[model samples]
Target chain A: MARFNLGITDVRKITGALTEKGYPDFAGYALMSLKLSLEKIISNHGFKESGAMVSRIYSDDNFTDSLIDELSVETTEMFRDPSMWRLLRERIFPGIFGTGDKIKFWLPGSVSSEDLVSLIILLKESDLTTRSAIILTSLSGKSLDNIASGVFRSSKMEVSEANYTKFQGKGELSEYMVKEGGKFFWNKNLFSEVTFSLGKSHLEASATCVNCIIFRDKMIYMNLTLSNKMLDVICRSLSGGGYFIIGSGESLTHTLFDKHFSQVDQNEKIYQKIR
Target chain B: MYKAIIIGGSAGSFQVVTRILSSLHKDFPLPVLLSLHRLKHIRSGFVEALSLKSSIPVKEPGDKDHIRPGIAYLAPSNYHMLIELGSRFALSTAAPVNHSRPSIDLSFFSAAQAYREKLIGIILSGANRDGAQGLERVASLGGKTIVQDPDECQVPVMPKESLKLTGVDHILNSSQIIEFLKKINRNALD
Candidate 1:
């Protein structure tokens, strides 16, 4: 019900640009981007008194980068949703790891590398680390490298420990990290089995059918069309009977891929790929 | 010596924080910590812009940075910011709470552990019930708790939910928040 004060031409022009840029849901994205740009421009220019200028700048792309950056929520944590990990360990992994002939685990859109690391820890605890190959792919090359480096903020140890306890983790979370001058550094040995790569979701690439594919919390940013397309890609990337996991808040109910993937653990957001 | 003040906001929050920061004096004594729901892909120029708009210094919190008075620290775009008792600020790449990273709950819970009775927790405009449990934790630990007036907030779910969960010390609008902060500071100074 929010009314945009922008002219029709401005709206059309912005919409066209976003559409041409391969954004499937142009209108919603444009509206959100415009709102964020308006706020940033008004505040930065100290033009609080100039409402007209604020409206005019809303549709402009000059502040697009900054606005998008501010609006994007890249918050993720290690072993987040420990229950999901618990389900993966106790229920999912026992079946998958039992086959254990060089299992491949993939995490698409792996931001900051926490979830991927969490998977690695779970794999290690399950005695599947030596036999598994972990692949972490993200658009941000920097984040990929950071994951490969295996460094983490020391302050996270407490919650990570709590999460470990919640999952009934056998070993100490502290055993995986070392304190270095107030910073908690993750053990590099964990990464000895992980492969970090930079890749976009829409790109044409090939990944062998893996044991599991964890794409938690990435689909909410995309529109239904893009989400469907991504889901198609995910289904193709996942091997037969492999696992696919997503954020509990996100649903694939409307997507065509839903029928192809059967829910293994609904509350834990885990699904198994079927024909 | 002033302790930290933790503020949480989500949907419809940009304006709320702006108003609160605009109302406060530049010399506000306590170290202010903020956790706003934001995407990880975005480059946060939020602190710089907010610092320019307000009288106080604003910066995205760095790992182990000491919490200094008169400066405002924001949880980084993708990380949760926490306060340690020795006036140190810690940042973490922890999992999302209530489906949000840089969660108000994470910061508030960490501050409760670090500052205990000295903490002042505030829940402002947001779409979800993220800060409700965190505020309860604060109150249980004898920390001061405040919720933005649900009637006045751009998004009232957070404050309203917090109210439902526990008894808050105050429910005020952005305009009155400055006065409340000043009153608390005066009591500490006294």
Candidate 2:
């Protein structure tokens, strides 16, 4: 399949078509990013053109989920940014443990299984596996299933192992995995206590509260309007004095909710809700 | 008139980048976006080193940060910097392309689409062919393309690859690259 560029006009048209078909409104995504994603999705899926891709997405729910998965970009690796994990282990987790309440974490949207597996390892190492509860949600059921399975590509292991070294894990990351048919699969029991939900609306509908909300790197794809809307939901879900971690290159400083949180770690983009 | 300038380089392009940034007019009229390969783990020093002689302020833009004139935005380590529709920056943690996270091709691809004929893309010295396809996209989009003269490059592989891929608007050495930018600035001002 030959690669083709999706111009801004094409992006807007596809976004409109998908939303009209009852798919989530992705019109708020950054146009250039969406354009590139659409281009790749078309080429990778061998869609002869954008119109056919859109038609298939409109008719097939599973294909739409796959498209969402691709658009979200599966780039996360285990223990990504080891310093952040180290900080969580050495300082943040201990502080949360001191609150004398069960620790809860909410990861909204289609977070990668690598991230979930990494968190489970952290919990096990800290001996807090039974004391913490995690809520994971995504627009795609396939993504939720992926998180539950805990299988990941071996290609990412090299970088992940290096990150684990920097994170100073108690044992090698490989020690926690069973290699099967060239893929690394973690024990599914590690997520035995996790709660899985279908979409972002689940967080709001349940009025779920969390001790920390890890919604990192996902907002860069959203426009300011959608970002702020999601921030409102995140702020509501986070209890006062709770932690909010984001991507290092992302900032809440310009958002409408900046006044509600104070920066705890500038370089790591960690924030604490003051109100 | 050029709305922005993007330069992609790796390996031996640091000194070349520093030279160009140092000599660019302090009030340069367009935003400068840079995607240079760097050590992912050691993040604090590259900006400081580049800013040492730069008359214009250099920064690593946070995700969604709005683009501004006269400022040079360096792609953050471990992320792909993309130009968004609203003239803001969008950083992605997508897997590295061509074994590089701050892949020059990814940056140039997005910028060419966003700015079209108003964009200026330049590929500098590097040891890989990461920016070759990107220069081709820029040329196809009607954006101006440039490559550091391969003969003058410390590692001629990148520029040579770009030249092989696209007919760039200019093949300039270090000083000539600066002169070209200054000329663009002067034209914008006039």
Candidate 3:
């Protein structure tokens, strides 16, 4: 509990400073997440005081970018919530495969490459990779670059492997990775046709008529107002009868966009646009 | 006026929690926030089980859901539930703390910041130290803090850890805790 030492006021000061510096308005970001992430950024970057951090944020462009990069939530793991992945592999992917001229998937808010990698592996296993166009977007170029390079933390490999097993993958997850300098580098060929988009918010991300969008757990960080705004964009991006998936525990029931999508699987939080 | 009651419990604490919730009047004025360790994948059954004897509504609050009085909000499995400013619930999928995702410490810390002295935090029987630091935070924020008496606890580790952390306002058994809750509800009525 003491670990999250920053108060709500500190969170406001940090977010407010960033907003005044021409960053996206984070007033709608969940306050507790902002507080915890700010506490981490402040401590990790060795900013002795919020005043010093504010001053630095005002004067330094590179530091501001780095700060924003640090703040982009990267909580996703490969094949997270295996049951959802199983459903995607066993049902959703097969149904959508060969549907479009090129099955387009737009995965937004990927601060880490695990979710994208997982999707690519699934597509490859389903023999749909060649006919697919994947557009991955993120708030930070650094995250996009990391995804492009295929470099990931070696530490997460074990968990990813376990999730893969539970996801009922055809083969070992390690078959697709190589270890170098204590880091796991994924097969870059898998992402050869992938397009990466960097944007500050959903409105700036370029994707239209996408057949599938896997945006899990990201909305938990946003307040209702921001969520509603983002949901409008996400809902519009998907074509009629397209699939949408979110974190197992997340719900769109309270949002205005709920009416546009009907539930596909309640446990997996999978939905299909009803049009 | 007390705005909410936050309770943290883990192993061996379920029955005690059921007792407390079952005993509460349907018109209990404070929202009860419960953070309990549960199997991450088994999502549907816990809320139903708790709701079985609970006189008031028991819900697993969605992210950004409004915090209303007279309902018990159980922290959803695999997500960290928080009390954000403006009396709304916030959920996080950030890494777990003390190996629990709906982390007891995170919930208590956030609720303490959100409600301050108007909050009541209770630590119940459990097998771990997850709620100890949180109970300390509650006390630090000027909120009333209580821990189930260790001797009466099924596991005793959770309550014992709280006793080690801070000078809690009360150390009560299950029945006494229920009485304390009734008294507070009655006082709010007056």
Candidate 4:
């Protein structure tokens, strides 16, 4: 196990410094440390202390652009979890399609285009595309640019195939991508109906309410308080009878939202807006 | 003969399982057990998917199911499946270990206590060091320990981490893993 050795006093000092610098919670510290560690920005003092220092810096409005640039996971793929996609197609879309109202889908932490593409495919297959609009948002501007360009390494195709199969898929996983000049180009049709945006979770919630919101795998890095607050924002943005899908491994067990949403499918982590 | 073989994996695992099972002849002996880390709330039809690519019978394990040869048993979603002494399988709703339920460590640890030397433990592609400690218990009890070659693994962290923590007997790829199992079965039959 990867252990972090920090004394109580150390935790207090770090927490105090972070509060003084205005970081919302310990997650800013963890995220900052992970970024710096990956970038080899700090060493010798161990990751915990570095995390504290990063948290302190992050809370300051004057934190450097280079520092922010270090804290991103740029590699995300489409049809990442095909079972979830299939679940959305079979269980969730019919309701939205039946409404016949213009639908909006929010995909936060959409690092690359793969997830957006997956959503598009699901909507298309469900015949919900004509009535739906997608908002693909990510914390990193660079990731947004990469998605807009729609270029990716060919090697990722093999892994994507394996992931697709793991989800009990029915279609040929390869039908979604094309190989071009040693790089695999994602199906262009998927993105034609989507809009990509650059944004962060810490910012105020958007005015455009959505029928479904997906923030998968992103909250595992956040602390409880921040995660709950963010969940609140998500709940606020969701229209009544909307849906929220979290990462499969994540839970709202202790949160106020725990009973507010009914589980659509436990394994896919899809939830329906119940209350 | 060993009644069951349990395998565990995390990150970069799907390919490893594919390779291991694909190499088996249709009539290979013994039931195979597996516990893999998947998205917590999502149902992964792993058995159905893997069955399409392998000759052996594959299905998610059920409570009190008999451990039969020539079948592959997968731990179901959100549950830890263990092997009982009398060729029966047990399921538990235990809390998550190392932040994961259906944990590789929990299944291997339980199997180590129950099956002892009769168990075969295989650790495959994953990012974390979950199975390293439990594999130690498996080895100490005379159980066979096989780790996928870190070099060949799509995600080498788990295998490499195990190498650092314990003394394992074999490090091979997916194809070689099948061959090793066949050899073990052949020797046991003799």
Top-scoring candidate (lDDT):
3
Which residue pairs collide in model 4, if any? A78-A114, A248-B40, A249-B40, A266-B41, A267-B41, A267-B42, A267-B43, A268-B42
The list of candidate 4 runs beyond 4 A from truth reads A1-70, A74-77, A162-180, A187-189, B1-190
TM-score of chain A considered alone, across all candidate predictions:
0.76, 0.94, 0.94, 0.74
Best by TM-score: 2
Candidate no. 1 TM-score: 0.53
Q: Candidate 4 docking category?
A: incorrect
Best by DockQ: 2
lDDT of 3 at B38: 93
lDDT for each residue of candidate 1 in A1-275, tens digit (9 for 90 to 100): 11122333454464455445443243433232233233434456555333444343356544433333333345555676777888887887778767647888887766566787788788788777788888777654455666676778765666667677887887888788887886777888888877777543333343778778888766644445666777877888888998889865456675667789889874567999885
In TM-score terms, candidate 4 sits at 0.54
**Candidate 2 residue lDDT tens string, B80-161:** 9999877989888776889998889889999988899999999999999899999899999999999999999999999998
Q: What order do you get sorting by TM-score, best first?
A: 2, 3, 4, 1
Which docking class does model 1 fall in?
Answer: incorrect
* Candidate 3: segments with Cα more than 4 A from true spot: A1-9, A98-100, A154-159, B188-190
Instruction: In angstroms, give how far residue B75 of model 1 lies from its true place.
Output: 21
Tens digit of per-residue lDDT, candidate 3, span B80-181: 999998998888887787888888998998899899999999999998889888889899989999999999998999899889888999999999999999
lDDT of 3 by residue, A1-275 (tens): 24547756777787788778766647778778878778778888877767778788889877887777778754656888888888988988778874567899998887788889898999899888888999998877777787799987776777678788888999998899888887789977988869998776655648999999988888888877888888888888999999988886678877888888998875678999997
lDDT of each: 0.69, 0.84, 0.85, 0.67
Candidate 4 C-alpha lDDT tens digits along A87-166:
77776777777767898888875555666666766666556677888887765566677777777656457656776676
Q: TM-scores across all candidates?
A: 0.53, 0.95, 0.91, 0.54
